[model samples]
Target: DAGVTQSPTHLIKTRGQQVTLRCSPKSGHDTVSWYQQALGQGPQFIFQYYEEEERQRGNFPDRFSGHQFPNYSSELNVNALLLGDSALYLCASTAGGKGHAPAKNIQYFGAGTRLSVL
Candidate 1:
């Protein structure tokens, strides 16, 4: 089965510009989450999408938004980007079922799209 995948592998942008990143969830999965990983910092959850709705979100500005399609793929859009936005944008997928089981609720991540804002 196919796993989560992200696009552009790498990206470069300037301050005040906008950027969009894409993601494909793992097979038989319906949940996708986006995360931001700075050079030396752990990944910080941006948001999670399930059934085309955001089910959970982390501490982030309004500049960060996302969408999930019926195909179970997702896209993250950032408006008025900042140099601080430079980081690795990771996409995670999980089979949303039986949430009571920790193993069944685990998330799988992709290599991520590296965004560099100058």
Candidate 2:
């Protein structure tokens, strides 16, 4: 398995629209992280989920939301999107355990979903 996979490799939307992206984590991974990467920029953290709950979040607005299922798959939802929201949405998976520091957990990334908003 490729560790992580995302659906709708490419998507197109207009301003004020909403979008949903899906992700499936690798086997044995219990944590999921979402990121946004703009052209010529590094991936920006959006949030992290563990045990079907949001554990950490970045400096994004409430329009960005996500949910994790018991199976560890996740979906990221962006509402009322703007042109600036056009970017690559990335999904990463890692293992979570007692005494395991977040920074120490190795994250495996998916190819990412490219979103274009006009």
User: What stretches of model 2 exceed 4 Å from their correct place?
Assistant: 98-104
Q: Give the least accurate 10-residue stretch of model 2, judged by summed lDDT.
A: 95-104
Task: Spell out the clash pairs found in candidate 1.
Answer: none
lDDT against the true structure, per candidate, is 0.93, 0.93
| 52-81 per-residue lDDT for model 2 (tens digits) | 999999999999999999998999999999
Give TM-scores for every candidate, taking all chains together and pairing residue i with residue i.
Answer: 0.95, 0.93
Query: RMSD for each model, in Å, please?
Result: 1.2, 1.8
lDDT of 1: 0.93
